[model samples]
Target chain A: MAAARSDRAPRRPTISDVARRAGVSTGTVSRYLNGGHWVSAESSKLITRAIRETGYVANSTARQLRTGRSGTVAFVVDEAPARFFEDPNFEALVVAVGDALAARDRSMVLLLAGDAQSAARAETFLVTSGVDGAVTASAHPEHQLFERIQAAGIPLVNVGSPTGLEDRIAFVAADEREGARLMAEHLIAQGARRIAVIAGPAHSPGGTLRPDAFTAAVDASASEGAAPVVIGLRHGDYTVESGRAAARTLLAEHPEIDGIFAANDQMARGAIDALREDGRSVPEDVLVGGFDDSAFAGTEVPLLTTVRQDFGRIAEELVDALDKQIDAGVRTNVIVPVQLVVRDSTVRPGS
Target chain B: MAAARSDRAPRRPTISDVARRAGVSTGTVSRYLNGGHWVSAESSKLITRAIRETGYVANSTARQLRTGRSGTVAFVVDEAPARFFEDPNFEALVVAVGDALAARDRSMVLLLAGDAQSAARAETFLVTSGVDGAVTASAHPEHQLFERIQAAGIPLVNVGSPTGLEDRIAFVAADEREGARLMAEHLIAQGARRIAVIAGPAHSPGGTLRPDAFTAAVDASASEGAAPVVIGLRHGDYTVESGRAAARTLLAEHPEIDGIFAANDQMARGAIDALREDGRSVPEDVLVGGFDDSAFAGTEVPLLTTVRQDFGRIAEELVDALDKQIDAGVRTNVIVPVQLVVRDSTVRPGS
Candidate 1:
């Protein structure tokens, strides 16, 4: 009786928490709670159950009063280990965004919305937490929470241009296609024929964009009819160990490849190591190029010749977009430029 | 009169804005607004005037009844750009703290409290903001805001063992002195004498403890009254650029120095560049050792010999302590051990 009483005391539940618990999306829950004539009977029943379970009693008096906005901007990302933080490219991008937000006197909230549970929690929190806006930097395309967030009428600025959501939302992202073209052009100019491209995870927007751009550039280049014998287009999970494994596979399967274009720096370094193990000298026998000219790109033995994204600028643009959306209700799509950083991995000094 | 009433509808005044108008500390203004009971009548009067002038009201009834804890922890740091995000050391530490807090459904707030104004703002926010706790990671000994946070009875955790506040608070820190001793002993065993030390900012507790330990180790290793010459002690701001400057200054001051001990990996790499510039070979002419075996430590041209602090572990310890403080009301002091990583910078292949 005591447990039941404690649970039943909160009679009026918050619409957002209900949305989270129901797994029916914030929009459905909000619509039902607000009695928006559009909510289906089934959705309303689910919302009612979620509310009863959460036991979130809404203060009717406070609900009637207008609450002023909190000048906070939440930046949600996959704060999982061994991926974003360990990768310099991701770190740089985050810092850039943080810097941009700071300049605008907006407090940035970092939410590690990694798994489905965390993502759902994050979505509910954002919808109800009273932040003015949000910036979603999830590299994974299948993160469904963003759609829910958009439907809930919260202002958002996505960091990476994820597919399926591109038609509906605006995002600030690095020009991977241009970056890949630069990498391919550099390798081609260096007299590389047999080019192998190591792609990022197949699902991510960056993963597909880079490889696509590389193939398109090869098709358009003067070496016209003779496209680089695309040998062993292996994939890695954007980790050093995964890169090492991908390198091993590429080497074993396509031993004749003279040039390797890794979608990111870590894989490029791994490719270089595998080539060295196979007794092929870098920039002499097999040239290499990687994307996201991370700090490690310069530190590797042969010095990775890779594409550089202005992470700080990208972040700044993102912040600007978020701020505009939050203040003026205007969504923006920003394209950050990338360039090729020439280094020892592609060009032999003596040669 | 109706038009004037409509025009007088106010914008929310922030703590900083109140402080600027009141001519008092933000903490004083916050305390006055919160009915802290500790603030004097004069302070209250000033705060009231500022509030009235700015058309600001505490909205005390709403604040007390609603606005449940923000569920955020502010991770305050001293420097704005000392590789806080770039270096995996601090990033890992933050992640650990974030992970711990997130498990308990709390958010980690990153506060880059680099200067006096920001520090004051942080103090005021710590006290008045709905956050349950704070974790400060600055090396500044006279951090007034850190002191204020402690005074306000806010549960605090320092990342490094902060000076002056060590007794009244709990901290999770790297065993810097022990690490320094290990490095010194290893260098001594390698026959390095006339060692010049490139230390972090001398004002910092880490700076004092590390160099003191190194000196004590050298003295213990020496025969009675036969101490090796310790020359060219230079200070750095714990950045690669500062390290480069210090390395240049140290070499110019003591050309006979056989080894270089840098307080951080950035400084050690700078020392390596300085050695090469001065036509001196590392390990042969001048052995190099650094603290905090960062990723760059392994990538350094000669692979830096350094003390490796498990930053990830330290981060875990910090977050753990914060959790205890937040949940169980228990305070703990944890000192994570460090290891000596022997690399080509100090140990030649033949030697």
Candidate 2:
């Protein structure tokens, strides 16, 4: 049977054949094949000529099948339909991931699995849909989609750090703890004495780690003899409405609060709206900070001071981790860095 | 050969068998198989039990292959990556389309073919990727993606009316001309005289038809012996920044303009921003109107006065049209209705 299968294989040109014909290294040919961004012009021309001469078709599907892959990947977002539409961060990440996958000559199938029925449908699709691997983003910790995919022994990469299943699955994430620390420190440096937080959903990775890290940083920054004062801590579901509601609660309970740190940018915008309604001016009255400098961050009247997570880099890392796991049976955990973007919302006016 | 093919057919229970066992119509069985949303609870239970007893599985891929179908559909968006991310309308349509396809047990593969090279890649993928059919949204009239897909003889359903190709392909669109006329008439009825328009991209269907329809409506409403007075007409790329720039131009050229109609909501928001910057109050000094009552419309402070397209219905129609083309070689052109949503932006404060 093995001999028969070997004999039935088609006479397709491999990467080595193209490289040999072009008088270049296989690595150079590979780079050219995966979007010739790094390949020299002369090298690219030579490689193209060689590929044409050899009648080499980059049949990714055939290649993937030979190695027990389906040549397709699922980009599963685990948010409810409404929430998925509301969040710009999710859209940015998905776009970046799609571009990354396209450059590698692979197709992306989008699956939104929020509830039990959808999760079951997603599980069934992943298991029998002929997709070789999967990448999940913005999944709530309680969602069973990831567990189901993992249980089926599918090679998968989680976009954020999975809480309980971290050690078991590969993941790529922005350092939420560090991002929160940066936001908290910036607010304190802006002379905010009483800081309140609009924490994200409790079951999400960002929802948990961001608030914890912010509180920890606040406590650590206190004076030697000064006791840490907990003003207000409210949880939100990462929607603008939720953010506004949380801000209202904080305003009523901790009227003296002068700084607000929202886990994400949407919540930050909502907080700004609430402050404006209550006759408070941002940066002048209360310094505001947000995470994930999304599209809305810059469009607001006073630009948001937030942590900029490199979604493009994070997407690249996700595709790379999933590719490695699929090709070599190895797992990877990648944490892309975040940068603080200071804008009018956090800076003291006229300073 | 025919006898041998018939002999080799798989021994699987068919839809008719399930219908007979469940004591229901074949249509009922089919509806239950396709999400069962409209099916009665008792009927659904009966169908489920019948399917289980007969070991019936709705293996779409296998069924499609037997009839030369691919069982997959491509949802192509011909917009730049940044614009795709910024527009909430595209996101909503995609989400709704995904849901519609999921109900029918089909998978959706996303293709963002913005430029020429990517369009070529998309063309190749669609022609050879084994997608049974395709649905394209927000494509420019000059884009080659649609032409290439058409040339390749792939069944396609366009989201909006294709200007010159309307008679050649199936489409599902909200009546852009009618929607524009409604907005214009509403603005005039609100007692605005000098009106300006921020038109969409010139090469798109909405870009051309919306402005034309608005102008026609304005001319039709004019008093006898009074030629239509054109105040300001400029083009935008359907973005907030473009809207702001266009509004600035209008303010400079026609400062007395009291009514502004933007082709879409993002631009409408930008126009509102510019008006505010110039110390002009909305609906008091100038009435601002937008198109596509997007998520931002209701969230804006004054609330956007815009046309609301039933995106959910449009998505369903697109899928249904494509499905018909694939199943029985039939094509459909559906135009859904749009409603005018009046808000504070277009209403006088104390009216």
Candidate 3:
């Protein structure tokens, strides 16, 4: 059989045909076409090849003109550059989102909104850099960034719960509270009593919600006549150094804590390092749990026990929501479920 | 003095005025404007704010037409995505290149040219992606990718030696041979006699040039009546795992090896890990030196001693070369010097 020979007619290939070529669900294809978020790499590659082979075009120039849309989606990261590069979680998401967008045949312009100047530049980039819509991540809740972006008449999608614009804007998030609760329960079941919580930034969703759920879980367990209780709570900026510092501080202040729940994996790793320096063993001495099972979690010497956010599903939902909003002037809010991955960090040695 | 309020006449500010405001050399500003590299972050931020405050524009739309520019540059990386993310060197270049470009008020569109399909896509991106010029990094020499881009009449400035069509193209390279020479001298001076070379992919500029230069240095040092000798050679895929695997094989084959010269930092780290597992002490039992003095080099436990490639200078030269070629049809080839950074890895512990 000939490997390549498909030039039947000059007519354009419809998205449905492209979807058939990719062998993915039509809904997935729609998500891909609209906001470039949820499409898997394999399907995207196949769809891309199929489109190239068939010369698929989304619409005529006239329709594009009528829509007044540019073929660009702004990938807005509202965290400082250091945080952007320091956390593997952000890099993983960036790669995932970029791939998803590429599959949809839409170009993405990355904009950093970390400081006032950078934020202003990002706003300028959105308005003057031909960006039609934006997908924001880790924006400060008090900054009114999303409101400003929406006010610019551009569609927006937030990675987590929108800062304060939930009713009008769209968002996609993992179940952070449930993830935290599961982690607490896992530690309790593993015989952890005096637990410590290393939380994220105070106003950020993970910082506030994850710690709240963890505390509630501890209180509920104690109410049910369980032995475990929250002994201390310290905050970290979702960084390894912050986690390490917080752990050192907790160890200095509350040495009786038997379990540590870090809001993110970086902090958990940091806490583990702090424990080792202080001549303590993980799980055996103080059980540790973290959230956001990042790329490097499994690579660690003692593999991390963490809450897993299915980035693929999040990307899919984010793309779908953005696509629907951009195309039909609608808003959607969806929370993908999270899972607890038990690894070396939580399990007792030799168990 | 007032911190704000500068609303002068509607006429656009000039580059000279912007340069003067930033207190940087005129050459630096010109280099920045032509292609987005070489300008340091501190100066770029100042220049950007100055331009913003003054509402500067390069020229009229009619002049822009005469120049046939899109204000967009294609930052082409001719490697697989995994390779792109794995090596810290690539990311450093990306951030540096992006910063360099942004300072000049030019946008960069990233394109990958790893496989045949991606190569085709890159070519298409150069022609159809509104790319005015290209700055290619780590492209395979045999691919004739530069030829195709030049044939497409798009101006280009390569990050290293261009594939085959060298005479017509512009390029900027770190002094690879000199860098290798210095590292070899450093290792030899540290009392290493039996050295093993963990090389990169053979055809890459670093893979070929660094090994050749290192071997030459070893031979030249011998001619100068030195004691160091080449013990073995192994190739790695510029990954930590590859370096570890190569080191394992080298140790099995040549047990007498006393020094390691990995072509890159990733492989160097891998070799270090392999050494630890083999119950060998670094510097005391075996000395190691790496190249690229990557962002993580100082962060490593032993603090890697390696050849430092000035990414900022490379970025600047690359931009200048491309700008010259694109603006005046001139071809430039310049080699910026590299440096040897001594650290914990090579130094004797007691010393």
Which candidate ranks first by lDDT, i.e. highest?
2
Model 3 residue A34 CA deviation in Å = 15
In order of appearance, the predictions have TM-scores of: 0.69, 0.75, 0.74
Tell me which of candidates 1 and 3 scores higher on DockQ: 3
Interface Cα RMSD, each model:
18.9, 11.0, 15.3
DockQ of each candidate relative to the true complex: 0.04, 0.12, 0.08
Inter-residue clash pairs, candidate 1? B73-B109
TM-score of chain A of 3: 0.79
Tens digits of per-residue lDDT for model 2 on A57-150?
A: 4433334645444445778888666677678888898789878977776666677777655665565445433466889877665557776677
Q: Per-residue CA lDDT of candidate 3, range B1-351, in tens?
A: 222422211122345666777787767655554532576656655665544443343321212444545465668787765567767877788777766766776655565556544554455434333346888888776655675576556678888665354586688988999999999988988888889999998667667889989999998895334478878998988999999999999999998989999999999999999999999988779999999999888997888999999998898887777778767778889999999999988998886
The alpha-carbon lDDT assigned to residue A62 of candidate 2 equals 33
Across B142-228, the per-residue lDDT of candidate 1 in tens digits comes to: 546565565545678888777666776799878988998898888888878788888888665446788878878887786334355
Tens digit per residue, CA lDDT, model 3, A1-351: 222422221122355565677677767655544433566656655655544443333321212443534455667887755467677877777667756765665555455556544554454344322345788898885555675566445679988876456687788999988998899889988889889999998767778889999999988874334478888889999989999999999999998978999999999999999999999999789899999999888888779999999887887787778878777788889999999999998999776
- The TM-score each candidate achieves on chain A is 0.77, 0.81, 0.79
- Scoring the B chain of model 1 against the true B chain gives a TM-score of 0.75
For all candidates listed, what's the TM-score of chain B alone? 0.75, 0.80, 0.79
